[model samples]
Target: MPVSSENKNGPYKPQPIKKVSTTTVVNPGFFAYTNLTGCQPYYCAEQVHLINNITVTALTIIIRVQKTSAATYHGVANNFWTGYINSNHTDNGSQIIYTFVLDPTQTVVASTTWYVEAQMDLYGTSQVTSADTYTVSVTGGGITNSYSGHF
Candidate 1:
């Protein structure tokens, strides 16, 4: 038997992959404060914008600390939601977002602990300024938040 022209077109071909990588991180909200004088004390009393859909108590805040610029985050946790930050996930503004399974009934309190780190020397000119503004930041729920304090 003779074959038709359209039937001999070989196997079907799939389309190409189209994935665009993002390189920019934008900040929607920010938190700022001042630490008068202390020695690596656990930083606390920081406030974050409470989102409607997100349950505050169920979600844990992944924190990153920086002295001068928004880079080089290496600090220890000193209070609730405590954790250390390191050089990981370079593309996500040096901060990592860790999603957690939380109870819906859990109610999150405002002005909770933000960050806790050993008192860093502020006089050093290498990577710190006179005030030593330490920035603690997190990104989630389509919102970017940061807390700055001078210790």
Candidate 2:
């Protein structure tokens, strides 16, 4: 179902649109992410975000999750893909990338909203959740930038 943006920090801001094609435009201007808190502490428990895409061309999004600490599973679960891993070897801190293609034929409208989420879990017998610094970069055809958050 189409949803609205619920990212606390705001939509991922494009540092400089110059890097991407001049025709590109970013919506919401904030990157949505969740830093693991005591309330929702879980390993690889990705956070959810409703991406609001308002543009002329279809949007292609790439979500990258970066973990600085050792973790059993670290990846991004988003609207485009689930449990995506770039490397076969996964453990103790990593960078996972996931992609989503919004074609013009799809029900997702150009000026509508969509959902995207991400999370990472550590290997342990018990739930050891803490605010770990992670950077999420959303890259598209003519748009690209990163946001720093915790999870």
Candidate maximizing TM-score = 2
Cα shift from native, residue 4, model 2 (Å): 8.5
Question: What TM-score does candidate 1 reach?
Answer: 0.29
Relative to the true structure, how large is the alpha-carbon lDDT of every model? 0.30, 0.40
Task: Report the lDDT tens digits of candidate 2 across residue range 51-125.
Answer: 434332344444454544344444444444332222222333355544544444533334333454444454443
Can you tell me which runs of candidate 2 are displaced by over 4 Å?
A: 1-41, 44-57, 72-93, 103-107, 124-151
Candidate 1 C-alpha lDDT tens digits along 19-95: 12234243332232332222223322111112222323333332223444332323222333323222222225433
TM-score of each: 0.29, 0.42
Q: Please give the RMSD of candidate 2 to the true structure.
A: 7.1
Which 10-residue span in candidate 1 carries the lowest summed lDDT?
Answer: 1-10
Which pairs of residues have clashing backbones in candidate 1?
A: 40-118, 40-119, 78-116
